[model samples]
Target: MTTPVSLTIPTPAEAARWAPEQIVALAQANAAAARQLDALQLEFQAMKHQIEWFRRQLFGAKSEKRIVDASPHQMNLGELPVPESSPPPPAKDIAAHTRRARTTDYAAGDASALFFDEARVPVETIAVANPEIDGLTADQFEVIGEKVSHRLAQRPGSYVILKYVRPVIKRLDTQAISCPAAPEGVIRGSRADVSFVAGLITDKFCYHQPLYRQHQRLGDNGIKVSRPWLTQLTHGALSLLEPIFTAQLDSIRASRIKAMDETPIKAGRAGPGKMKGGYFWPVYGERDEICFAYHEGRSGKHIAQTLGTDPPPEGAVLLTDGYAAYERYAEKCGLTHAQCWAHSRRKFFDAQALEPERAGQALEMIGKLYAVEKHIREARLVGEARRAHRLAQAKPVLQQFFAWVDAQFESQGLLPSSPLTTAMAYVRERRAALEVYLSDPEVPIDTNHLERALRVVPMGRRNWLFCWTEVGAKYVGIAQSLIATCRLHDIDPYTYLVDVLQRIGQYPAANVAQLTPRLWKQHFAANPLRSDLFEISK
Candidate 1:
């Protein structure tokens, strides 16, 4: 459904209308629009495009990719067809179909009954007594094997409190009293164990559960715990992980090709009932690891801090959108800056309603580029072979795409400030940066990988909403970086966190990189240190 874009001024024109705020923004950007008739009309269409963009953000589908489907011709003038008295066509029989078998067993009332992984689960056996078996002799029952059935069962929360009862002994010689030093808590002399701390961090940051919610759940489960203690446990765990996070961040900085983006969060307090704004600059490395670095502002300085001050190697690539700060940083660092086709395509997609034919043509051209990329992946092209594939397949499409944009501009028919021209200019100007991926095999076509890695922040934002302190936000980044990297490597976040929380105290400081998810998978993940609870449960 299309939402109408409304303007405050009635009868602005019969051609287009825009939202009031969009008109104001356009007028501010182009001061002459409010004065000249031609500029006003152009701003009308431009603002219409802006209004559609806002509408798309609020109510439209999020995906920007497109498939080129043949649109039927919508007009036929001065055409007439003779009516023929033809016999009715014979009807064809339709085939009967059956429903696909599902995983849920309705009769037994068990969900996921068909997809159970038997090897991973330990079986608990229960014996049932039948009246016939009561009367039968033991020899008769002993002669036959038993039949069994399986059902997946679950308990809420699945948390167990270990009531440790350590023996207390007094030394008779010196009247010295002693008990096993209470198994070390993450906090000095605190009762909370490393296992509890690991679970709290995983549930809060990785699962996106806020501490107050966990506190409420703990209360519901008859376990009395304060919300502040959970917060403190999280801080304590992250404090131990700060060095490892720094080490991983260094590894990400050393990668040849990287993608980076910023996201805002409400961190710290501005005033009463207010929040100060901050950003997390997340960088994705070639080694398949990501680091989320927190900074108070979105600027080039933060980019320099995360990447480096010195210039990158001769062929290093950095993928990003047309964000000005990234472009500036890339230029300053002498990196081969590549732009995202998805970002360019998104602009034309948003302006589809304003100029359907132009937008459709641009979209069809961009679709060809993506199709070449799809074939490259399907063929499993790698290294120099991948670069050669892009050169042979994608390079021609890229050339055609840019030449089409240049033709549209040279024709001099489109409004100077209209969305279509703006989109064409955008692609035409970035031709150099957008063509970088054609020659470099390791560089990705877009920053979607980095965007995906940083999504935990936004997904968790919906649940937790905001952070009370900047320090809390930093801790959030620290935990999320490792957790996100763990996911990239297909490692379990809960298992990794539990083992590291126990092992970090004794792990060598110089070998801290071994604990980062990328290195840990290769070295330490085979037989990681386990908490006392894990050992006892086993």
Candidate 2:
């Protein structure tokens, strides 16, 4: 009852019925239709990939960790691939051994190092008077070790003000007043004490508490302070630490191998009530130090500015993600550039949904590279020895992986611009860069450490939002650089800031490197300067 929708195709006989001109036109039309169909299919697949990406962003697991099981319900598109494994090594049985409790003898004589560990907390003592002791004389009842009990206690409003009340005295002969001058503070003629400044910067940068929120907290605590005053205090505290940050930054740049990456921050004003974007180029040094250098633009020139325009020292290497700027910089500067393996693996990860079998094969190969890195860490290999092991174990795996990728290209089964082909092309192009880590022991197989250090930037942006100005963003970098480095060195950021803030004003400019957290840990951490209130409590 309905009209039939039949697809028509032109055959040789149908063309034969037409004139010569008509036949040529029909053949051109048919070829054009084939090309159009291919384009449409490519577009369709791209849209599907984008839709799946958005869905993952909204609902899927954020971790890129390889999954042990595949095709779990509700997780089809972006599920990570776990590599196929060979048979496990045979287990060897061991004789059972007795385990000891962690607590044991420690701190004998003048030594504090102990086999048994204890929490590092302040001790508060109180004398409990016994009624029996009140009735007995000192000689009548011998004093033995008293029973000890412990309970953890905490109090709110823990803030304390350091009051340095100076005694006023007058000379009888000259009528001159004399008192000890106030100790060096973080800022000149500023009411904000070093402890207060340290806490403000630490809370804002390290803890992501914005100035407005901090102002509210102070108001709630009965210490009324202006928001502008807090901002000024932060600026002053950061300015004091700039020299040390520079020294550490130089140390990072001078390392034999280091990581570099860029992250965006909304800094400066675009128009009324709007912000412009800037980037933080964070460099992670081999010594575990980091620096967040702020820039108005992300370009290869900035990388040169950080690493230098000159040819680097021999054997110097730069580790980075697959960013073009780093590639250009390293090439222009005549430096050895190594790419992250994890990034190459990520491309295949995204394509797994479309080309499950092919992408799975690629992911499994890359996963073996990670497995080698894990074993390297487990063995605690370093220097030449680590390099040797990687050459012996990791090099062969890499060779085989590249061979597979090359075979994929020669087969020519993957469509041009398709996800599978694109991933394979990315790996094939960077084969040399990917293999650089295998040759150098110091260069990490990935930039995960650098990413971890720079995480504070993005996490902070969520709470504190954007910087009011580009200068403000630079100040943010300075504070974060020091705090992040403090974390790497296992030093308490609050204590480090308090000591350095008080010491920096009087410290020699030529020897500012000693004020850096790495050097300060050795020079002054044993007996650091303290707030007057804390000293009195001691």
Candidate 3:
């Protein structure tokens, strides 16, 4: 029913006569796809390597236990018996003993001659009244003049004792109502005397009473407060201070320049055989206004949301470690990134632990760069002065470092197992950011300020395990931010927390920003609105 199809075969000449335009277009398309695949493959490899390296660095390796089962032949160094030495002769009575019998004749015959010579001034004892001495003199006035008197001399390890000083409680008798349902013959303390009993809890037990173990102490004190109640109270106090915490965040956001970094925390109880990790990212802004945000996630989104939608001012910069997340966010926001040289140098330093001879040279070169920065920082150089100093002193060191790094790249293939190689790659990738501080006045040479702020997260993690919930995590962020900021300004955290908690609610919404740590410290320490709270300790 169907006609046989005509079978045809082209000759070599006909096949070679294909269109030149079509051949060129097809080749170009193939090349483009090959390039895309190659790029994707490279990215995937780099990311996989980085993740593997990070895992080793953070969790560390489970070291193999070397079992040396075979026992070696023992050679004993026998103990030599000590020969007993003869005892010395006994001392004779000085009053009845002859002068020649004594070994030291001067002590036997020269008792009267032992008096002071002309050079030895035994003259007189000078008595001075210490201004710091506590006591009253005549007329209820402190003594001011020196006089000779017998007094107990202070011995070694002695110090003036300071008694317990309690904060003065204020009572407000706005109104009163008599209660008719009072228990028979029962008496009660004033309600005004009640206060939030707050104390810092560390890994240590209170006089050897741990938190779970503290039940006995509470019961013995005739108080029936449960452990959970104490935990809730601590959280409640933190929640009450949240407004002041928000005020600090607002202030940090208002500044032109900001620095940020993160530290890890462990949540041992989050799941079975799994440790949940959280981050403490601290951001420091203008006037050294510091704030820490504890993030449960370590993605680039944290950076994006923390640093809002704008570039820091023209000369302003954000200092950070070589975290790619930071780099991505910084580029997106148009902020100049000032990379930390300490982090760069630290990588090489750790390399010394694994590969001493090879890492030594790289470390020496990195060390020179740090020496220059240390000189500038130690001179109290900041802003334009610091920038100028670093430029003059550090530029050459950095240039030398870069040249050496280039040499290493050409000569060395960094093994994934080597930490030095990882560090070198970090420095090599972040070369531009590392050099930014030399040119910009507002940029810092290190992210230490932010790092120092976030260290508490890890230190606290060793004790508290994980945050109980998201709300608990938020509470920690607020409390830690306020407490750490207070420390930054050299203000006592307890005093600052108390003052703010009592007055933050009363502060006008328009001026709530003034309650920020930096502002609050200045206001409360200098010209305080509440005179009773700010009185200097006597």
1 versus 2: better lDDT goes to: 2
lDDT of 3 at 109: 20
In model 2, the runs with Cα more than 4 Å from the true position are 1-7, 10-18, 70-157, 169-184
lDDT of 2 at 384: 97
Ranked by lDDT from best down, the candidates are: 2, 1, 3
TM-score of each: 0.76, 0.80, 0.60
lDDT of 3: 0.58
Candidate 1 overall lDDT versus native: 0.76
lDDT of 1 at 221: 51
Model 2, global lDDT: 0.77
Number of the predicted model whose lDDT against the real structure is largest? 2
User: What are the RMSD figures for all models against the true structure?
Assistant: 14.0, 13.0, 19.2
Which residue pairs clash in candidate 3?
Answer: none
List, in order, the clash count of every candidate structure: 0, 0, 0
Compared with the true structure, all predictions reach lDDT values of 0.76, 0.77, 0.58
Which residue pairs show backbone clashes in model 1?
none
